[model samples]
Target: MTPLISPRARPLAAALLCGALAFGALATSAQAAFNPPIRMSHGIEYMSGGIGSDEAKLMETVLPRWPASFEFAIKDHQGADFAADVHVTVRDGRGVALLDNVVAGGPFMVARLEPGSYQVEATLRGQTLKQPLQVVFGTPTKATFLWPAGTDMAAAGTRAVQ
Candidate 1:
């Protein structure tokens, strides 16, 4: 003798299967919608030697002005066989400092920043190099400082003289 399931039982099984599938689809969609995308903010690429004396001083004062949790990049020039210590300072349009004392070399120190206009400064070797850099919100920005070989305070002063 053969046995058969009742019509009611068949409907219940079908309903259960459909409910499970719906739940799975909803879970998948939710995960996809909530996932955050990767982003980048600041980068500094140096060529020639590195940050000159003037640039170094500027960076020291600028980096601390940025809000906490910002991305940054620093690339040293490969042509010159010299190492440089680079620093950055960030400020807002109101002349308020946001970030300071950010230092890096080689291909390290990448970070992200909040969306806002910022003034950036860079320094190398205790000398101010570049200042008043403008950083727009939600946009990737960069600052590069080139240091020639054997740059001395006197030489830098003379260049300023010219």
Candidate 2:
């Protein structure tokens, strides 16, 4: 028996199939782009991201599993969260740098580090703030930095980093 389908319809069907496959590949890649990287520190696994609601949600879900976490925020003396471009550095007890040259995209950052003494330094507009933190077992610690209100952050030339 001869097939009843026409040649013209076969080419149309093949084109449609190719288009669908291409769409699927693109969709998968797009979703993967949103996935952030998880880094392991001194036997502790952590991820950092609080730039937007989507990343915030991801950090919220991951917080419970990690024993220690660090958050960065630029707030005025009144304690209002404000956006600012700041450079962050973390050092261990021996003055060895744990993490350096990290730029926060937004006011908040979450990270996990081993339970120990750490020194956190944030630089903004030529002013530096230093804070000492200790991470204990089973207790999730948070550190917040508040920038003075009277100063003008805009003149500092703030920029967001990924």
Residue-wise C-alpha lDDT for candidate 2, range 17-97, written one tens digit per residue? 899999998888845654456665444444565555666656656666665555544455445444445667788899987
lDDT of 1 at 62: 38
lDDT of 1 at 34: 36
User: What would you estimate as the lDDT of candidate 1?
Assistant: 0.44
Top TM-score hit? 2
Off by over 4 Å in 2: 1-34, 39-46, 77-79, 82-84, 150-162
Instruction: Provide the global lDDT of candidate 2 against the true structure.
Output: 0.63
Pairs with steric clashes in candidate 2: none
lDDT of each: 0.44, 0.63
Compose the digit string of candidate 1's lDDT tens values, residues 65-157.
432222222223434322334565666677665556555442112335455566666565665555444455544455544455444322221
User: For candidate 1, which ten residues in a row score worst on lDDT?
Assistant: 153-162
